[model samples]
Target: MSPFEKFLKQLENVKVIEPTISYDNYVTIDLSDKNPDLNKELLADAEKFEIYIEDYLQKNNALVAFGGYNEVRNLYKRSTIFNGEDFDERNIHIGLDLWTKEGTEVTAALNGNVHSFNFNNSLGDYGPTIILEHLFEEEKFYTLYGHLSLESISNLQIGDEFKKGEKLGTLGNAEVNGGYSPHLHFQIIKNLDQNSGDYPGVCSKNKLDYYLENCPDPNLLLKIN
Candidate 1:
């Protein structure tokens, strides 16, 4: 494994959601094209997609349905933001998504300071996002929290400090969170260039290798499964 990957894997007891919710209450979810239970019919609208999630969680006897790291999804086809001017068709999700109810408390996976935050008020975009800067034994990295409530960043400043598992924000609803089910798009970024507040959570096929390396599986820290 790469050094960053090693650093992430060695970290222990990281939780980005409600601290009270144990990993046992967290169930893995598959929104990829390979999941036979998923289809374009249910993915066209946020309401349908949410119902699908609620059903899955209910079936699994869980509170949170999380997955989607390095997962290719069909939902991005509805948004032009994924398809840049060149029409590269970005569909692979690079961040780990935790699906749950709106207003659910979201926390930091580790001690960090706010690197940036923004309200990317576009369809299929992260409504309210916060990026935290962290350093582990001289290995600097970042953690991004997307699909957050507007109130999350209302008083947040660029360099705000937060300890591990501290309340960083809450999950947003479909109206504000890029018109999707309420969930937290949590990611670990090793090298952030000039981008702040926002980074590409999904990538095109050509850039998949780079993203997968830069943004490794966040489950390494969360250990949800």
Candidate 2:
């Protein structure tokens, strides 16, 4: 693990969703190509995908389905954002996803201030997104909350402070959350590289090594494993 990742692991009381839901209610899900139950057909349509996720959650008796950091998935094939003009295909998910109901509360992983937030409106994009700047052990890092409700960013200003587990925003629905099932795309970014409010949550094979290093598995902090 990188030094930042190690520090994250040592931190305490990290929860990104509704604090009422305990850890036991969270289940790990596999959305990679290897998961036979998930297919192109299901991923191609937002409503279908939401239905599938609902069924999976019901079957597993879990409120949240989380996973997909560094997992190669076929879910992006339907979106030209990852495929257009770039045959390399950014299908390798670099962020851990927490799938749950629309409008579910999303909180900060640590005490931090809003770094940047934007409405990345595009097909298969991180619709209302927010990035928080956090400092610990005298080291600075960032946390991104993507696929958020439009209201999430409506009243935000730069440098707004939020305590750990405090409500940063709520999850967005398919209509505004890039046409996917309502979920929080939570990622830990070591460096923003001048980017604001958004970063690549998926990567291509050629750039996987770099992205994997710069964006470590968020589960290291969430400890949802």
The numbered model that scores best in lDDT is 2
Give stretches of model 2 more than 4 Å off: none
| True-vs-predicted CA distance for residue 91, candidate 2, Å | 0.5
Q: How far out, in Å, is residue 12 in model 1?
A: 1.5
Best by TM-score: 2
TM-score of 1: 0.96
TM-score list, all predictions: 0.96, 0.97
lDDT of 1 by residue, 83-172 (tens): 768769999999999999999999999999999999998999999999999997786799999999999999999999999989998999
lDDT scores in order: 0.91, 0.92
Q: Worst lDDT window (10 residues) for model 2?
A: 79-88
Error of 2 at 3 (Å): 1.9
Candidate 2's displacement at residue 27, Å, is 1.0
Please write out the lDDT profile of model 2 over residues 65-168, one tens digit for every residue. Answer: 99999999999898888997847789999999999999999999999999999999888999999999988677678999999999999999999999998999
Find the 10 residues in a row with the least total lDDT in model 1: 36-45
